[model samples]
Structure formats: C-alpha cells, structure tokens
Target: MDGVLVDSETYWHRFEDEWVFAAAIEGGDPAHEEVTGMPYYEIYDYLDREYGTTVTKDEFVAAYQDRAESLYGEDVRLTEGIPALFDSLRAEGRPLAIVSSAPQSWIAIVRERFDLGPLDLVLSAEDIDEPGKPEPHIYERAAAELGAEPADCVVIEDSLNGIEAAVRAGAYTVAFRTTHNAELDLSRAEVVADGPEGLRRVFLGSE
Candidate 1:
C-alpha cells in the first residue's frame, strides 16, 4: 500500500531521517532500512531497544499519527495506471487486497483519499496476534480472509520484510522496484518488476 501503491516512501524516509532519527537518537547515522516497512509503532520499539530513543512510545506513535493525515492526504501521489490495473484485475474476478504493516487507521486514510476502488480486503499486521512484517502470519491471514489458498495468491511487494512475509506464506512474490528499496537484495522473490508498466505486465501475465 505504501511504496507499491503510492509514492509515500520518500516522505516516510524523510520523516524518519529528519524527525525520528535526528530528534530521537543521538549520534550515529541511521539508515531507513533500520525501520522501513515496520509498523510505525513498532519502529519505536525497535529504536528503544536498539539505539535508544529520546521519546516515549506514546509520543512516537502520536507523532506518526499526527503526520499520517497530511502524508497520505497531501504528500503522497497514487501510482500511475494502478486504477486501470485494479479495474483489469476486478474484471477478471480477482480478489484484490492491500496487506501492510501499517495500522488500519493509516491504511484507511490512504484508501479513502485515493478512492482505491473496491478492495476485497484491507488487512493490517495489527489485526493478527503475531508481530508484523518479515513474519508470514499477516499474509497467511490475508489469504485466509480472501478464502483463497496461500499458494494461489500473487503478492506484489516492495520491501524485504513484505516480500519475506509473502514468500513465507507460500504465495508467489513479485518484488517491485522503488527508489526506497532499490538497492536492497530482492533475490528471494519469484520475480521482479522494474516499473509500473512492468508490474502491469506481471499482473496481466504479459511478461
């Protein structure tokens, strides 16, 4: 839903570098990878245990919540041709979903703002009992909710954690190229799409 559906990764990284890392941590340079694709609240927990943060968990969560409205509402741009892709998939009776590490509220704002069309399901890692991304539970749950076999689902993901989760869930994973994760290794994915058109081809089975 983030890097794959919208150009929110840049803003998210900016916020992490400028606000979260700069304001919360002391000296060492922090890579966005340290927390990228994590649930916003989970990032705080990670930071608290790893590098130690200056803010309380409540403060960290609240700050992200406060920024989310503007981030999704104004800063992010929907990916080009995605609506067309969604239409094509829906026409084929595919049950589409946006399974993310984001909390439901954050996903809700983006869905409402972008008019993402009729998604069969919108899932959050928080909806499950286990920890978020890099874990297969959320993806497993999404497949369950969709009434589909996990091995039958094709998950398009742009983050390592997301790809790992999807793969572990026994789904076919397509690694998506995005500036945010462009340099990271994506060999675990079954396939890789280099652009929106590449993604479209994958969805349409043209490649």
Candidate 2:
C-alpha cells in the first residue's frame, strides 16, 4: 500500500535512506520512484548492483523487515476516498484485492486495522513465490486468487513498476500520483490520476 492506496512512501523512504542508502550502500538513494512497485528482494538486488551495498543480501533483507514492522502501522496515511471506494466496490460485489510489494505479515496488520476485510484477496510479493513489481507475478497471483481473468481485473497503482506489472498482466491500470513520482515515466499506464479521489472514474466506468 505504500505509495499507492496509502501514503507510506516516506516510511519506505526512511527505511531506504537508513538501511539501504546509509548503512548498506554508500551512494545516496536513487529517485526510487521507478522501482516503487518492485519487490523488496528485487529492490535489494538493484541497490546492490547500482549502488554497491557492502552488506550481504540476506542481511539487508533482515534489516528492512525489522524496520518495516516498526513503521507499517504508525506512519502510513491513507489515500483520500479509499474508504468510500472500497465500500462502493464491496457494495457492488466487484472482486478486489490489494496486490503489493509490502510484506504479507505487515500488510495483514494494516488491513485488519483499516477494516479492509471486504477486499476479496490480498496478494503480496510473498504469495507469488516470485519477484515483485514490474514482473506481473503478484497481480497475476491476485487475479487467480480472486477468480478473475486478468482482463477482468483493474489495477490501481502508483509507480512505474506497478503500472508495468498491471500492463503485463493484461489488466487495466490507473496510476495514482500521490508522491512526486512524475520523474518516473508512466506513459504505459491506461490512466494517471491526481490521487485516490480521482479514481472514481474507474468504478463509475466513466474513463
């Protein structure tokens, strides 16, 4: 949900800036927007190659998980209109799921706290047993779990990786510009909106 359904990019930013850019890699954080929807493992690998992390991949992974548990619930801020949107979707019985790069354990807490039980499914990078964003595996798994064809799904994403993943899965995609991620090109997405409130068009089928 970070940088997508909710405003948790900064939480991720803290994790990246501390563990990723500071402790692990000597280089400053990349824009990171292009990689937003990517899985943490893929992200760690990319940072290792591009920024030269001294820590082992496993060490980096552990550090991220530890910090993630601390940050998940407290720091996240929801995207505007998300509650109403979910309510509407639930009312219509349109199958919906949150397919994200965030760890499943962490997402569970947030989901429960937010009363997101109506979401028909929740698929994390962990569920796919594959790499994360930009790969389409997560969303593909989500569609399967929800018993929806890829073409029947509509993905709401925030970053380039999320958009690309949806496109690869053959689903309609809407990119939400919550953070300043315009630096990450998103021309491939079907729709780019100002925020979650702007996403009413998808449910209304006005787009």
Compare the candidates by lDDT and give the number of the best one.
1
TM-score of each: 0.95, 0.89
List of clashing residue pairs for candidate 2: none
In order of listing, the candidates' clash counts read 0, 0
lDDT string for model 2 (13-69, tens) is 666665577677767558667456787778778887787778888987887777777
lDDT of 1 by residue, 1-207 (tens): 989999888899889878898997655677876677778787888788888888888999899988888998889998888889999999999899999988888888888888986999999978888888787998899999999989999999888878888899999999999788889898999999987988988889773
Name the weakest run of 10 consecutive residues (lDDT summed) in model 1: 25-34
Best by TM-score: 1
Each prediction's Cα lDDT score? 0.87, 0.76
In terms of lDDT, the poorest run of 10 residues in model 2 is 198-207
